[model samples]
Target: MRAVVLETAGPAPHLRDAVLPDPQPAPDEALLRVTACGFSHHDALIMEGTLRRGVTLPRVPGHEVTGVVCGVGDGVPASLIGTEAVVVPGDIGHRRDGGFAEMLTAPVASLVPLPQGMAATGGALLASPIGVALRALEACGVAGGETLVVTGASGGVGAHAAQAAHAMGASVIGITGSPEKAQRLEGKPWLDAVLLDDEPWEEVVAALTGDMGADVALDTTGTSLGRLAAAMRHGGRIALVGQTSPDAAPFAPAEAIFRELTLVGSLGVERRHVERALSLVAGGQVTPLVHEELPLSVESVTRAYRAVKRREVLGRVVLRPVGF
Candidate 1:
């Protein structure tokens, strides 16, 4: 097996590909032939040593994974062999070896059967962030005829949240930092409107919602919470999922009390959320946007990490491990 190993963490971390023996499955695990593995911004944070709580050294740091069942241990279904599956990202990429290798082992219970006709790299992303989006939407309780606002709507999680919220019948408004993203989201069927992040979002939301304000807001950019709250109607809900911005959002305690706002912190996804997210993909209700696809190699991996770290890409970036 070939794997990218992050042996040390620093301001300038280097990931090198190493040759190793194939991984064997545990009694309750299955061995998968890696197909596609995608990168996340969190992967950059882990490599940079900023988010180092659960991350261990000499690790393969990818969680968005999809592969074919090549082998399974005792008590696991033999029929799973040759089946395409997605591994829901969790402690695997954080604590143990992950999908950067040619083959990896995962608990059979953690594997989700990949739906037919879905792209492998897209399946990899649906295994992780899309599920997080579903959980955020559930936290905010978006419903039909309501207005939902999403910050950082051009990024992976926010993009998926926008699609899911719209598919569920809510009117969506996306907030982006660039005019290009705003124009892009404005043309999408999922978003009813698009606003620049620098704009007066509260006033825009009021006008867009006929002075009632948005019923729910998913704050994908953590620093926009105060403005998001201001754009919400009284008793509205805010689902927070990211902490990308350095500064905290300024919101008065009196504002929450007077508006009777419900603020919810969505951490990660559960198994059920993964299933629902994939179903959306299978049904064509949501598209997992991949900004770039690189062959799995030492050089490509380095470039992928750089792109993710710099936030140069619009959506998810993935790696093809099988052919490469």
Candidate 2:
């Protein structure tokens, strides 16, 4: 089958095509005919050599995928064949060929059945970003009536995190770098307010929270928005998820210590968190924030990677293996 292979990693991904051997599923795995895959900003970071580790050259870089089961390995349940499922981009994407192909293999444990009405594009995103959002909220221990701030609030993880935090009864303050994003989040039930990163953060935070700081802040941009640190109340918790800003610095040790703030770093979601994200989407309590869809082809993959590198899109960008 044809797959978009990354020939090299540099400032941008080098995407090309190659005819290769079909993937063979392991005993506990399933072979999926990928229908959709989510292109992440992290993919660009991986390509640029900034986010090191996990990626192997001549690779297919896609983790958030959704597809139908076409085959199953020994000891796997035969009933899964023909079922629509979400492919969890486990650590395998960085090590193995991922969903940028017509077919991909994943452990049965990593597949989540699509909810009755969830589209493949939406299902694809639920696997990674949504799972991360759920885990971030869990780590921060956000509660009802509390005020939470979400950075990069228009991106996939940030959007989902804001919605999830709202579902958990917290009032969400969304922060984004664009005016369009600020307008997008305004008046949304999930977000009590939206602030532009260009504004003075102290004024923005003070205006949003009535002079008090947020009870919790989830920084998805990974920028040195020290204003985010300043916007937190003493003893509040902060969860660092991504580093969108190349210049982001470590938190001031003194501030964190003196304020008794909790700063935590979150990695990929665990099995249970993935399950919870799926359940939330299945229940219609949360929606996947998809920005655009491109065909699953070498050219489109390259374009998508470049778009992400340029920060030109919002939410999740999906590639459709099959025409949608």
User: lDDT of candidate 1?
Assistant: 0.85
Q: What digit string (tens of lDDT, one per residue) describes model 2 on residues 37-136?
A: 9989877777776776867787877888888999999999899999988866777568888888889999998887886767889888886899989998
Q: Rate the local accuracy (lDDT) of all candidates.
A: 0.85, 0.83
Pairs of colliding residues, candidate 2: 221-244
| Every model's TM-score | 0.95, 0.95
- Please write out the lDDT profile of model 1 over residues 209-294, one tens digit for every residue: 88988899998878788788778888999999887755778877776787899999998787889899888998889899888888
Candidate 2's displacement at residue 129, Å, is 0.7
RMSD of model 1 against the true structure: 1.5
Best by TM-score: 1
Residue-level error in angstroms, candidate 2, position 164 = 0.6
> Once superposed on the true structure, which residue ranges of model 2 sit more than 4 Å away at CA?
none
